[model samples]
Target: MSSTHAVNKTIQEINEKIKKGTAVVLNAEEMIDVVRKKGKVQAAKDVDVVTTGTFSPMCSSGVLFNIGQTMPPTIKTSHVWLNGVPCYGGLAAVDSYLGATEPAEDDPLNKVYPGQFKYGGSHVIEDLVRGKVVHLRATAYGTDCYPRRELSRDITLADLPEALLLNPRNCYQNYNCAVNLTSRLIYTYMGPLKPNAKNANYATAGQISPLFNDPYLKTIGLGTKIFIGGAQGYVLGAGTQHVANPERNERGIPLSGAGTLMLKGDLKKMDERYLRGVSVVGYGTSLCVGVGIPIPILNEEMAWFTGVSDEDIDMPVKDYGYDYPNRLPRILKHAKFSELVSGEIELDGKKVPTVPLTSYTRSLEIANELKKWISEGSFTLTEAQEEIPSN
Candidate 1:
């Protein structure tokens, strides 16, 4: 490495440059070209931060809120339901969580044939974020210290003391490309899959995705600032099902839903555009959350990792109709993102069309927006308070 290319830096040094408005920030797409043209060493010397983004329906996401004290100002809330959707009321007081995947209590869960299943916790959350009124109904076993038993009221997010976007597991580092091998169609969280390998579906922004840019999570960890739901958020920790060990390819990238993140942000500041409710046919309801993470180019290695391209990332394909539902998520074949983006993948020697569940266009917007904030000295990367577990 030449003197011009071989330069080592830190998050603090990058922060100083960001503060001075002299930092050269780039999105993951641009970083790919920079690394290709100038090489990793030169790219590391040139770029300070690389921004990445992903917008997809993640089921392991939800909103946590405190509807404030009811009339008597005392209610040991035991069971809470929002807009006919059952909420997790295990928390103290009027606090409850609306899980994105939780169905309504009286929901016609696929029992009514020839009808699309819709309306759930996710939709209720979207309504709140959009400033629409949400009906709140609760019941509790009367206690001495907190006596009130039953409470019912229509409340908006504005009525709450705090509404938080608290996601347990999100941004699965890698995921499956689902297809059906059986003779009939199958609807899954990945969306509707055509039978006989006619169509396949995947969800990821590829190279520009957050975890893809920092595969090893070298700089992304606890307390790392991020662009989430069109607002600033922090990484809480390694998300649920997150484990350090996983199967990796030659490039050291995981082959499954390996690396994950727990994230939190102020729901009050979130934009409805980035936080949306979606219902998959026969699958369930889910929240589409837009998330972006900026990686400080601390060294040549960081530059190289951020330059990961679609062609280089491979995710395994699974038969959602046959293998997936039977507890055997067998990898029929591994397909490249480049191929998936091309709208087709050759599965079982058949040319199957591919569909993406996430929006790359929205992802680009988020990355660009974050870049703009950083370049304008409005955003600075945070040094992780704790490391994300990785091997």
Candidate 2:
């Protein structure tokens, strides 16, 4: 081979650039373009950009080349690890049931009722009051590789990550707001299609009033409790959302971040829902008292990675640092989206592209640094910089 043949390949150069902080991230197409420019005939290109940010709710931001999308490259796939297990991240149906009903008085005793019965809904049961639900869908892209629906028992108040617990009062306040909103949306605003599973007299629409007319309702076997139950799968789905906040921003303008993620399956059972509202709403409250972690701030002393004894979670969010708070979630979301869009887990180095994200999530309550970096394509390694020797 000629002496000129002894040159470095493009990918190797790019990897070195990444390691040295020259390039933030590069996708397949861009990597190809960079390789071609290197004057190398067959340089390898393995890295793929998970996605990009079009517009973000966090301080208005967008990518230059991709003018219209919410995030760049439109995050095709994402992954996350929950409880030490790597799971693909995408849009899963985050739902909760209104609860079951029993026979009520005034109605004649029927086979379903026990002597003029006392009717109740799932939410009415104090034991099932916790709302943190898990919605894991077995898909082709999950880290496990095999297809299976994996879910966590009910998520208790203790299961919360501290980033959410920034200000105990504010965290609680946020929880209340989220819970109240959930109660109103799921119960009052969202009604059952058919009342009593029938369309007959007194059945204009079976509502929650039979119990106490409480807007808030919970599901049985769906509370923040632990139960070893098997999971099932159903149809796959997709969705999108955009909003313009008028009360906060000075522009009085409508800014939005619109993107899509795949929902692996329908809610075959209560055990497979995200229980999103409940989880966010009850973070630091009495609901999560002693079982798991608490709401966390973007940065806090108690928050660190798994090996970092200063904290509890094996992979705490603070490890990623505040600069990347959203990194983990973004990666997980991307992995899920990729599976939805392509039907498999995308690779990033030896990992499944998602391991980093999940690992990062467990790093701290939130990595504001990672979040900013992904959403805005910018982040300052302030913590690391502070520790660096000042020359």
Candidate 3:
């Protein structure tokens, strides 16, 4: 906890400013311009909070809710399904979790690799948030206290009082741009990859992503309030497969996938637009969740970090055609996010078309929304109860 610059602020001080309607907040994109003009030291003194955001396909997202108890309170559900998709029913008799990637039990290609998965948990989540009709079914072993063995009903999200989004991993700090080196086309979570490295796809909002703004996770940790799915949410802890230290440049910019965040929020308060379900032609179902975090300019160093531009970020290009599936340790190359967003990049002396699984447009929208919330004193930053681990 040391500072490299001669400026400092605190979360408490920022919250006081929020209460007094005096906090100077900016989104990550705007912070770059401020840094360019005023420099980090001046920017640190001028800006109180910098907000970052992302809207991306997160396979680890899901919701946990307690369906209303059956009549006579006798249904001890042992299995559960929503709109033909299976849900984890082991939590409690009436509590269950629906994973974003769980294919519908009735999906024709549910078990086939590289199959067209039309619907799954993400769709179910969207339906719940949209207030659409959803069918609920369950089966249980009858007992003295729980006499019901089977149950079925049509329900909506409003029927559940404790529907909490418990995403296990999300908002990747950085990510690989996937390409196919093989002669034939391939389908992956990154999307379709044309044969022979003709196309590339990536995910992340680059400089605007939450963890990217706080590269070291110094200010983000347990209980940190965040903007998630258009609702107020909290950081639960480190995400699965989190990497504290990855390859970085001289400026400490990570050139590969690094840290991740686990988030939790009440789904009932979420906006439907920020939580859409998606299905890939050959891949499976996934949730496109919006996430935003406000990073306080605790020091000049923090301000400098928040000013990271797309040009400063580099990400690895990997071969999903072979290396990825084989778990081979190889990087095809590295490309700047600036170049990646330009819709194309050169690899192996060839121009390859590029796309992003994460929506930069939605990301900016989410960031601006958070900025507005802070400006209106409707949101304030929180000090982490515990710091996120690096390793």
Steric clash pairs (candidate 3): 244-390
Write down the worst ten-residue block by lDDT for model 3.
Answer: 1-10
TM-score list, all predictions: 0.96, 0.17, 0.96
Q: Which rank order by TM-score, best down to worst?
A: 3, 1, 2
lDDT of 2 by residue, 109-181 (tens): 3334333222222112112223344222222232333333333333332332210100011000000000111
lDDT (C-alpha) at residue 90 in model 3:
88
- RMSD in order of candidates: 1.7, 25.4, 2.6
What does candidate 1's lDDT look like per residue over 91-208, in tens digits?
A: 9887899899887766775567444558888888889889999889999998887888888888888899998999999999989998889999888899888879888999999999
Q: Could you tell me how far off, in angstroms, the CA of residue 354 lies in candidate 3 after the best superposition? A: 0.7
> Which stretches of model 3 miss by more than 4 angstroms?
1-5, 108-114
Order of candidate numbers by lDDT, starting with the best: 3, 1, 2
For 48-134, candidate 3 gives per-residue lDDT tens digits of 999999999999999999997756788888999999999999887799999999989788665664367889999999999999999
